[model samples]
Target: MENRQTEQAYSLYKPLLFSLAYRMLGSVMDAEDVVQEAFFTLYKSGSDHIHNMKAYMCKIVTNRCLELLRSTSKQREVYVGTWLPEPLVTTASDETDPMQSYLQKESVTTAYLLLLQQLSYVERAVFLLREAMQYDYDEIADIVGKSSANCRQIFHRAKRSLSVKGVSDTSDRSDLEKATNLVEQFMHALTTGDAARLMKFLSIDAVLLADGGGKVKALTQPLHGHLSISESISSVLKKWPGSFTCRIAMVNGLPGIVVYKDTIMWSVFSFMIRDGRITNLYFVVNPDKLTHVQ
Candidate 1:
């Protein structure tokens, strides 16, 4: 393809490609890098024989992500404390962001991405291509260089695993609004130290998980039970220095909070709401993972 055609292809597919990469790798920096590298490769190729620019570019990005996952597996195995995906912090003004536009909030969510991490890299690529991108099995097979039958099996296995994890579908508009309101109320209750109000918002079995990446103070283990989680939140708030302020933002495509401690980004909170109550709370405080928000 000519330079002009390649540029057009980049513009048309950048969002989709970036979304795929981000979901695959769960790192904003890595996703952006791999997508740029794919475009550069396409530009350098200057091959007119490539008839389908989208598929060609997708194959490039997917293979690159698979390679990255393999290389980084050791680092992840040794990661400090609980690991969390880098938060894709978005505000109302970010509506124009091509990547955010292409992303399905349900797929990019922290919970969903974490579940994706459970799959092998090849399964991840095939599953994402089939589920998020709506590619047919034949299409996914070509991208991942797997047989069509194998791709189909991989997609089903991945889907079954996620379903077993009780993945909550966030596609319902009313459910999303309810969750957003709960987040707002939860934030207010947190600031007010209203244990009673907080209890009402949490399921009896709610679990709290924190990620500090060993760079800062964080919980090394998951906290369970609504009562224990509530008490822990109150205790932590009382001990933390400085005045706290939180802004409700779209975190991983759901209504969540970006908390600041005297103007420094302290923590990013994402909730998994089920049955009108929070079932899981994710707190990411690692300074390294929060550079984007800072």
Candidate 2:
């Protein structure tokens, strides 16, 4: 009966647990593992020495996840060119509030998360918990193991630093629209073999990252320079052999282009547009990751 009850409790908290983990780690696989590990710890404890199972479990999960993030920062720094957060599919239920959900559904898209990587892990934690999850300072302090006063300070610092790093980028819908419009023109150039025009739409130091997971042939290294990116885009278009379908879709909460072949989803591409041109490109061609999504 005790074991059965534990399983029931875990089931009830699974969604919340997953959300907490995802917001912390930014990777689905890691989030799933953290939740499993948290539940394992919870089950082994046998519900003893706990006042609130929900909050206690959440604290455990977030701390474990924070530790993991702290350890992984070094690995991420040395990671392959133009690292991006793992792409996730956000559903209607993922929102914290119906109204906030409606507003943020168009705000927190995949492109937004990619930009978020520019933040330190602690800032990301504080911002996501306080802003996204609506956790109070006291609750956030519990999760982060800091004093409530310190938690507020941390969040304040995060906001100030993030402002310099483009936290306002998400709120600026006009900028996103203008940038995405340029991406559409860039894609259209691919089909029309307008190399010069395509080059015009890219920054001189533009970077292209393709997350093919080694399943398909992709640039083993990031493509750099406006000329190089233009050549690559042109070459791929020349080889594509047909009129491909492209649609503007929500990538996380940011505007992104969804690519398809026939009725099947082929790739999800998001652009990093700045200064009236695309400065970077992220192509998530990882078939396994897209399995549950598409």
Candidate 3:
């Protein structure tokens, strides 16, 4: 009976647990592994001594993520080119908690996740627990093995490290609609090999970062400035065999493009728009990262 109850609890909390781990580690496989390890530890320990199951599970997962961060820090140092979080195919209905739903929209963004990479493991835990999961300072302190006061200080420091000015609601329908239209125009230009049209949609200071994980053919360095990015896009189009299909999809809670060759996803392109122009373009062609996109 106890085992059955634990299994049921795991099923109920798996989505939240996975979300927390993914936000922490930025890899679906690692997050799933950490979640499984947490459950395994729970099953081995039994639940008789646990009073607050949710808090206990969260603490377990958070610690596991810290372990992963410590272990993987060196590997990321040697990663080729820019590193990007694995693109997740997210839907509004996946989250049951309204607050979590909102946080999911804001925190899973590629830019925000990149900023999180700058934080130390403890600072990351404190910030994510407080801001994304809505845990109180006391709860965060318990999870991170810090005092409530220390947790508050860490959260403030993490915010300063990321230089977060304000929270923008990316889920706003008007903003999404505008982004979708802009993405459409951008895609048309790229597909049609219209460099001038493509350049028009990009901000003057636009940058394009490609992640191939050293396993695929991609730019070894980031392309900066609209002219440079335009030339790169034009070069790719000129040599293209015209075998892929591109469509706009919701990537990281924003309008983005997915390229498909037959049934396999070939690449993902996410954009950052400001003042009706794309300020940044993230092109992810890394197969290892795209496994979860489908």
Candidate 4:
């Protein structure tokens, strides 16, 4: 293919390919690297004989992500504390399809990505392709180099492993408004050190998971129950100087907060809000993971 054609192809498919790899690998940096490698492969090999560029690019990116998955298994196994997906700061575009927007939200969530860790690489690939990407069984099989029947089985197994209801429509205006208000209140209580107010918004079974990646001071284990979570937050507030600030912002397409000490980002807090209460709180303090947050 000519240079102009390759550039057009890259511009057209990069977002789709990056989204696929990010969902598969759960790391923005890794996803970018994998997508770049896919484009490099295409550039070097030329796309003259490839009739369908999208399918070819998808296959290449999926295979590259699988390779990274196998290589990073040990690293993830040795990662310190609770691991969370890298939070992405994304805004929905007006031209995006409704179904695609919903799927994107479902796939990028910390809860959903953490569940994906249980599946094998191929199983995860098949599941994401079939569910998030809306690929048919035959198309998924072609991408993963498996029979259509095998792909279907893998996808079903993945679903059973998740064992959850379908992804809900999170764009509901009422829910969004409620979540935003709760998030604001939660942040206010945290910054002001009002444990009583903060605890009110937390569910009785609220859980807090912090990821420090062994490079920062963070909880070495998951904090469980509302009391534990509240105490943990309170303790941190007491120890932390008043200079640190928390600002409400979008994280992984949901209401969240970004923490900053002075001018530098210190951490990010993403919550799972259900019925006007915070169910799960994910604190990603690992500096490595916060690089993309700003």
Tens-place lDDT digits, model 3, residues 100-143: 46545556777777778889888988898998889999999999
Give the least accurate 10-residue stretch of model 3, judged by summed lDDT.
97-106
TM per candidate comes to 0.93, 0.65, 0.89, 0.92
Worst 10 residues of 2 by lDDT: 98-107
List residue ranges in candidate 3 displaced over 4 A: 91-106, 166-169
Q: Give lDDT per model, in order.
A: 0.87, 0.70, 0.82, 0.82
Residue lDDT tens for model 4, 79-179: 98888888875444422754345434555777777778888999999988988879999899889999999999999999889854643324677887788
Write the number of the candidate with greater TM-score, choosing between 1 and 2: 1
List the candidate 4 regions with Cα displacement exceeding 4 Å: 91-106, 166-169
TM-score of 3: 0.89
The number of the candidate with the highest TM-score is: 1
Off by over 4 Å in 2: 1-20, 28-61, 67-82, 89-123, 130-137, 147-164, 167-180, 261-264
Candidate 2: deviation at residue 57, Å? 7.2
Q: Model 2: how far is 4 from its true place, Å?
A: 18
For residues 93-130, could you state the per-residue lDDT of candidate 1 as single tens digits? 88787767767453788888888888989988998898
